[model samples]
Target: MEVLLAVVIGTLYGGGLYLMMRRNLVQLIIGLGLLSHGANLLIFIAAGLRQGGAPIIAEGKKVFLTLPADPLPQALILTSIVISFAVTAFALVLFLRTYQEVGTNDLDEMKETDT
Candidate 1:
C-alpha cells in the first residue's frame, strides 16, 4: 500500500511540476492543486501506516499496550487540505479576473498588463 501511494505521490508531483512550468494560467493553478495533494499524501505516508494495533498507550499504562492509529498526521492533512482548497479558489478567481482584463490566459500576455 505504501509503495502504491509513493508511486501515486511521485506521479502527482511530477505532473504538477510539469504543468506549473507551462504558460497557461489554468494549468498553473491545476499544478498548484496537484502539488498540494502530493504534499499532503507525502506527509500522510511519512507518518507510517498502521492498522489494528495501538501505537499509543493508555494514560496510566506505561507498558505500551494496545495500538491505536495516530491522529496527528490525519489532522494535519485535513487542515492542509482545507487551506489548499481556499488557496486554489483564490488563485482561480485572481487568475480569471486577470485573464478577463488582459484578454488572454497566457502568462506572457498577462505580464504585459502590469504596465
Candidate 2:
C-alpha cells in the first residue's frame, strides 16, 4: 500500500511539474492544484498508515492501552485542503481577469501585450 502511494505521489508531482512548464495559464493553475494534492498525500503517508482507535483516553483510564491513530496529520491535511481550494479559486479568478484584459491565455502572448 505504501509503495503504491509512493508511486502515486511521484506521478502527481511529475505531472504537476510537467503541466506547470507549459505556456497556458489554465494548465499552470491545474498543475498547482495537482502539486497541492501531492503534498497532502505526502503528509498523510509520512504520518504512517495503520488501523487504530481514535486518539482518546477511555473513561477513567490513565493512558491508552493500544496504539491510537494520529490526529495531527488529519488536521494538517484538512487545513491544507482548505488552503489549496482557496488558492485554486483565486488563481482561476485571476486567470479569468487576465484573459479578459489581455485577451490571451498563453503566457508568451501575454508578454507581448505588456506595455
Candidate 3:
C-alpha cells in the first residue's frame, strides 16, 4: 500500500509540474491543485499506515495502542485542504479578471502587451 501510494504521489507531482509549466492559466491552476494533493498524500504516507484504533490511550495505558493511527497528518491535510481551496478560488478569480481585461488566456500573448 505504501509503495502504491508512493507511485501515485510521484505521478501527481510529475503531472502537476508538467501542467504548471504550460502557458495556459487554467492548466497551471489544475497543476497547483494536483501538487497540493500530492503533498498531502506524501505527508500521510510518511506518518505510516497502521491498523490500530484511535490514538487516545486507555485507563491504564501510558500511550497510544501499538501502531495507533497518527492524527497529525489528518489534521495537517484538513488544514491544507481548506487553505488550498481558498487559494485556488482566489487564483481562479484573478485569472478570470485578467483574461477579461487582457482579452486572452495565453500567457505568451499577455507578455506582448507589456512592450
Pick the TM-score winner: 2
Q: List TM-scores for all candidates, in order.
A: 0.85, 0.93, 0.89
Lowest lDDT 10-residue stretch of candidate 1: 106-115
What tens-digit string does per-residue lDDT give for candidate 2 at 1-115?
Answer: 9999999999999999999999999899989999999999999999999889999999999998789989999999999999999989998999999999998898998666478
> Quick one: best lDDT, which candidate?
2
lDDT of each prediction vs. the true structure? 0.90, 0.94, 0.92
Arrange candidates, best TM-score first: 2, 3, 1
Q: Which residue runs of candidate 3 sit more than 4 Å off their true CA positions?
A: 59-66, 112-115
**lDDT for predicted candidate 3 compared with the true structure:** 0.92
The residue-by-residue lDDT of candidate 1 on 4-114, one tens digit each, is: 999999999999999999999999999999999999999999999888465667689786675777889999999999999999999999998988888888887755548
Off by over 4 Å in 2: 112-115
Clashes of each: 6, 0, 0
Of candidate 2, the 10-residue stretch with the lowest lDDT total is 106-115
